[model samples]
Target: MFPGPTIPNRQPHREPWSRERLMYERAIAMGNAIDSTSRYTYGSALNSYLTFVRIHNFPVDPTEETLSFFTVYTSNFIQPRSVASYLSGVCNQLEPWFPNVRAARRSMIVTRTLEGCLRLKSVPVSRKRPLSLDDLQIVLSHFHHNPSHDDLLFISMLLTGFFALMRLGELTFADNPRLRNWRKVSRRSTVTFNDIQYSFHLPSHKADRATSLAEHAVSPTLIQAMGRWSSEAFKIYVRKHPVLLHALLFGADH
Candidate 1:
């Protein structure tokens, strides 16, 4: 007789998913269009704004908000950088169809919220640092010592976030081949040449104000790892022990 023990069968008690939660499925669909944190951060900003809006029964959406509340919203945030990120997102959306949406230049708009340099009166926002080659090398070297899924996840983020210069929100995991494009970009390290590829068409910044923004996406190797080839389906690289970000494609930086 085989020495292995018999396995017990089990089934989940919870329903597959609730209807209200299912409603969020649309949001999930849209969320799936982009990376994970895009789902979180953008959703977080929207939730914050909407919570404030619903609380006061504000009649207008963020775009239609009177300048007064816009000011209040800015002053209330602990981190005005998020506000800037949110506004920049809206600006991106309006520029293509509604050119008149963003009136003040970015400097002026930010001046209204995030504080300016030289003690200029504006919002006081947080600061962030860009990753350097030395920093990235250190991260990879550490990963080499401790091989794990997180390591692969970070490698993808560094490739996209720094090399491809993708935003946090755009660097989502693509567990579905239907969405992610797997095309190799390089073969410099132990990673295979064909293993390189990333997302080809990542979701755009829903709040950007620029009229002619650059194409978005990340490195190819990342896409291969995060992007799935399923029939249909679906971090931070630095600081705070880092996190996840699916993958990127070609020179894309969505």
Candidate 2:
């Protein structure tokens, strides 16, 4: 009477996921997680690797030797740093299938090969020419007389970005017209004006990936420029697109 009827243990039956199905699901999840720009970069890298593989008839599962060869081959055309980036991109693309593929990029052979190529070929590192004061004056001269809304906006942005030392990404939208994450300069972010100097919070930047907001001082020149833009062009812009109150300070067509 003490023990109740014992139930027989039954194993639940389910169809196992196929390798292709698992890969597809993982890809979907990864695509959702990564930014569009990064995905494009990775895809480009993978394409380069695939092209190399096709030309050389290499296996899908790349060996350290194959990777080293690819690096050296690419180094002949591109800079060593670019070759390294391509290798990293290929590694990232393959990591889902081969977890240890990224390690190949870090191997001694790959490192030594890159170093040797760098020493052998004097590939000058391409650098962006820094904007000079003369350049700024030349640019501003165009908008000196009766500047349009667009001109005013451009002038203000140029000045603010230069003086603030903001990254292009921080100041402007993504290079792709389709993928724009416009950051708004809100009223709350701006501090009280004191003797023509005011501060505003930079919500996010490349270097400061964390949530910490950076405050930058607005020079009198920038303030005046902003005021001029806002008075005429900005007012018209706001009237045209009333919904842009909390949108990008420099609005785009979108």
**Largest lDDT belongs to which candidate?**
2
Candidate 1, TM-score vs. the true structure? 0.33
- lDDT (Cα, tens digit) per residue for candidate 1, span 194-226: 455644443332211111111234332333334
Model 2 global lDDT (CA atoms, 0 to 1): 0.66
TM-score of 2: 0.61
Give the candidate number with the greatest TM-score: 2
lDDT of each: 0.46, 0.66
TM-score of each predicted structure versus truth: 0.33, 0.61
Worst 10 residues of 2 by lDDT: 206-215
Tens-place lDDT digits, model 2, residues 1-254: 59754787575878999999998998799876666666778789889888998999998786788888988898888777778778877887888788888787788898899888888875655544345457789998877999999998888777766666455666666668546544433234465568866556766422211001111222323433543443566455444532333233322222
Model 1 scores a C-alpha lDDT of: 0.46
